[model samples]
Target chain A: MSAAPAPRYLARPLAAIGRPVLAGLASVGRMAIFTLTVISHLIRPPFYPREFAHAIMTIGWYSLPVVGLTALFTGGALALQIYDGSSRFSAEAAVPSIVAIGMARELGPVLGGLMVAARVASSIAAEIGTMKVTEQIDALVTLSTNPIKYLAVPRVLAATLTVPVLVAVGDSIGIMGGWLVGVNRLDFNSAAYLKNTIDFLEAADVASGIAKGAVFGFIIAMMGCFYGMSSGRGAQGVGKATKLAVVASSVLILGSNYLLTEVFFSG
Target chain B: MIELQDVHKAFGDKRVLCGVTLTVPKGESMVIIGGSGTGKSVTLKCILGLVTPDAGTITVGGQPVTKGDRDAFLARFGMLFQGAALFDSLTVWQNVAFRLLRGAQKRARAEAREIAIEKLRRVGLKAETADLYPAELSGGMQKRVGLARAIAADPEIIFFDEPTTGLDPIMAGVINDLIREIVVEMGATAITITHDMTSVRAIADDVAMLHDGVIQWTGTVAEMDGCGDPYVEQFINGRADGPIEAVR
Candidate 1:
């Protein structure tokens, strides 16, 4: 027997729900295609060495201070929280191990990635969006230059290579922050805290964080370029693209962090 | 010759171009005149292959614009955008010499700079203006720089999209005269899209009136005034009441 149709009142709610779902899925498909295009361009020839060098400096060297500061503060706060919790069970001595593991496996890469996304993604989107609006991108095309090769590839490659180094440095700074809190506030011996952190942190934990960082970097650059290139006209269009790039990159960073953690530790 | 045969394009529900057919013979200056949002620019872009048409075809020198080597085809043409659209980061000379600094037209740095300076001088910009960025220059200077950049490679075809839009009367006159002189001197085929009647008279060898996504009239500048076509007469005379609607 044939099924009866839904009631008239249900149609409005169902249509409202289905509309956004369809838009969201379509957006995801577009982003996937954009990512593949970027990958295809990455392996092609006619590389721009000068543009590449400039991107490395912009993405890597310039992002160092903010990443380091975020890691330091997060580590210090983690140490304090761990000490307070552990002391309830007379396990205050466990602060060093817990802080070390937390900073190395989670806080360092996630916080550092978020900071870079805030700084880099917004700027890339604004710059490229403005270019698109002003027709400089079309100008580049009329000059017989490929916009993807000239603009997207170098920036994406630079971000992918640099964020891991940022994460590694952030991990070290975070550990140092935890050490300082452990020694001065918790009344733990410096030598004992250092030994505990060193012993408890596994190589795989730090490696996994760095790997997460690389993925985050790729996401940041891709979101920036995709939104920028597809931005609408005028100042409002540029502003919207910039906002979307940062928001999307940040959410993706957090979501991917969870998935990466699950993959690395689920077994 | 460049030819567009029944080219059509649409964005969502709004149809921009519907069966636009026209031609510019070799080494002739063809100015397309139409009201705002009438697809004058789209027709130019279709010929340049910047915007793809949903139907019909465009060709340059009897070869389809969509086929063969894109770079080789583009190398034959240069364009001055309505906003000048200079690269904000590059200095005047660098912006002018951008095409020369890379790709197949790559030249020695000194040579490219020399050519850039010469083009700047040709556009009536002084040597001192070369080092200044686009933001540092006045609107007229920026337009001149854009014109210089378009001619830097000595392209065989050149396009001017609203070349005098933002300039004062004197500056507008200067730009119109410069475009005419350069097109003649270089023997370049020219396709300009402008509604500026003064510019039309100054630069056009032949004029085509585009309205409602089709050519309403076509003739030489001398014939434009007495063409007797309602759309062309209404547009050239700037009458608020006519066959064309005032409000888009």
Candidate 2:
């Protein structure tokens, strides 16, 4: 390619095709390195306890209501849909088992992480991006504090520790939602529904879902920090970072869920 | 003393600093004056290792700037940013005592606060202002807070970037005076970058003019008065027509 004198049509189309592909690959590589750097910083000394505590409260505790509501409605609707579909085949008894398995394997952690990504990632990006624009990040460095250590490490630690706990709570709320719909609308016996749900759920299933929650949480926090740190010097730059953080985290959450599911559940 | 030799830096195709060199002797204030985008800030950043130069050797106290313990190196210096850059999440006092609150310089809470309040007083801010966040302050007040923060740690060296950028003339004069007084009181090595000629006169023990990524002239303020260099003359007088293009 470096030695070639290609025709305009061929060169133009090829260049257009190659440019985005190369850019995409380069971005992926950059994100991978950023994730590694965050992880590396985690084990280092001089931890900022106050910042970590603040992040835990913000990322984990404040996220509960939204994640809880999402899980509850989703589980109840899933139970309703399963009952309707199962009745066609006279398989209505499968509703409880299906809801439990579905919530445990997929919806609970995936949806909870998505909700977190939307809320926390955008906030982190905007906050840090504004810091970058206003030179606050540079101020951190000039004060002998590393920006990554002060900003990214605490947030990442908080998300990793809290998202799984959020997933656990979300899963329980979702199961309860399924139970409510089953007993009230589907005419399912409450005792039997609860028993089937208990019987269908295994320890491995719960663990895998929690594990996925951790990975998704990492992706969300990392994207927020990376975009924020790399933001250009203006209000528009910060806005773009906020937008990109949300979009990237959301897409990554869904995509990683599929891959995680395949690893944990596929034959 | 801080010395930069043949420093070269570029962002993509546009060269910001090319073969630039200068020296700031110990315990003296050196003000770098230039038009916008003339690499004054870039030079300051390179000395502090905020922006790595593509090529050059920068030495602080006769040691390479890029080597040695970064935290230890940075701790020796303080900086006042163009926009104040006080952490919005922290109060004014916390911003001032930021270096004292953690890491190797950690001080007890009371001690840190005492120092912060003293610094604030020295910068002409009231003790009540300590508890207020940066958002609560006016632009001039923020600049004062920034000055207080820069002097908080009693650093051996200090850098000020566009210290009077947004202040009114009176406030600008006040800040310039405060900076001059503090630099004299501390007897610390100082480097300041500004396009404001008034600030240049008020703060500089020595002056260096940067133009098109190179040092156009360097001398004491008295020497600068009649140096007879066209670029320096035009910049100092704020003339429209000169060797430098107004649009470029």
Candidate 3:
């Protein structure tokens, strides 16, 4: 009897733990299928040029102010921190190159992507989630429109194309921001600071950041569309989807940044 | 014609539709009446292929719903959702002309706008209302825009899910009249899901009562009162005491 009870107790706890693990795995599978569907739709569409144009405006142009501001402040702060840290060893001259390389290789793309994720991911999820809740997506279906083609493909394509450009612009502004702070506050010569930054930033560094930006952009839009399209029901359901979109895209951005860095520079 | 034979659907452990079988003849206005959560919406969704059934066969015009070019099949139908479900980003006319402006039914910009405006007028909206976004309109106006959109494509089959829901009695009456007039005028088969008796009386030539996952009764509206089905009587009378558990 004691042995039988022990099996029962063990079974109950195991099932409880297994349930969530299974659920998480199922969600991952669903997201994989969703990603494949989006990619397939991208190539097979009676493409919506209008929707693509609108998405480009919404995801790229509208995100600029926030991306710019985040990069500016971050670059300035990085310069200050680098200057203070290196002065201890009389290595103050290393600040400009380090800041340039850091911004071009890491901070610019990551922060820019994060800012866009906070802005675009939440909005995309909310809009599409509300559409799902309201049955507009079904309405599209009834009207002989494929929701994935009409909605997800345009947004995903626009994001993939535009985010790299945003990263490039962000890298330039960031380097300028570091220069501004270094010359004004740290008493570095403006021309010397600019020369050092230019010398330190290799084409590969900038290219790698831009490449990461494209992947991060895809993650942001994919998470938003996937959550939105699969959202449960009602206001609470849409809210949950929006929250998940932001959280998932942000996490994926950071996680992929690590992997991409390994691929691009681990040699 | 639309037919569902032994349809079954369950979400998780909650069985929503169980062995529901019904038939809707062509050019007939069939209104499905049921209590809240009785699978009325799910039934419509199943017919539209928006929600797949766990087990069943559904056919339209003797063609299986699942077989054929999905786009061509969907082009035959239009649906008005309970919440209007107008695209928030588009203007009222743009919403109405959505189908016409794209795909196989593509029309010139001016031509599509003209058709959208004409449909808007038919639904009792002014031409000026066409340019305004859905959010800029009142609930009643939004519903009219939705109605206009439903008929814009002139689909052979149309479905209205709670067409008169959330409107004032006067507005409800107006919408019912509009729906009836539109169905008759277009010679389109219609399936409406509603619990509103007034709408059933106005819009249905025949009525089907859904209860306990299956259609409990179905007959002409004229025969509905004398149908003698306990579920139909309980539902028609809106009574709490009956075979159906009111709490559910």
Q: Measured against the native two-chain assembly using Cα atoms, what DockQ does each of the candidate structures obtain, in the order listed?
A: 0.85, 0.92, 0.94
Regarding DockQ, does 1 or 3 come out ahead?
3
Query: Which 10-residue span in candidate 3 chain B carries the lowest summed lDDT?
Result: B71-80
- lDDT value, candidate 2, whole model: 0.93
The regions of model 2 sitting more than 4 angstroms off are: A1-4
Model 3 lDDT, residue B106, Cα: 90
lDDT of 3 at A231: 91
**Clash-forming residue pairs, model 1:** none
Model 3 scores a C-alpha lDDT of 0.93
In terms of TM-score, which candidate is strongest? 3
lDDT of 1 by residue, B1-248 (tens): 99999999998999999999998999999999999999998988888889999999898999999999998999999999999989997899999999999999999989999999999999999999989999999999999999999999999999999999989999999999999999999999999999999999999999999999998899999999999999999999999999999998
How well is each residue in A138-199 modelled by candidate 3, as lDDT tens digits? 99999989899988999999999888888888888887788889999999999899888888
- Decoy 1 TM-score against native: 0.95
Superposed model 1: Cα runs more than 4 Å off:
A1-11
Clash counts per candidate, in order, are: 0, 0, 0
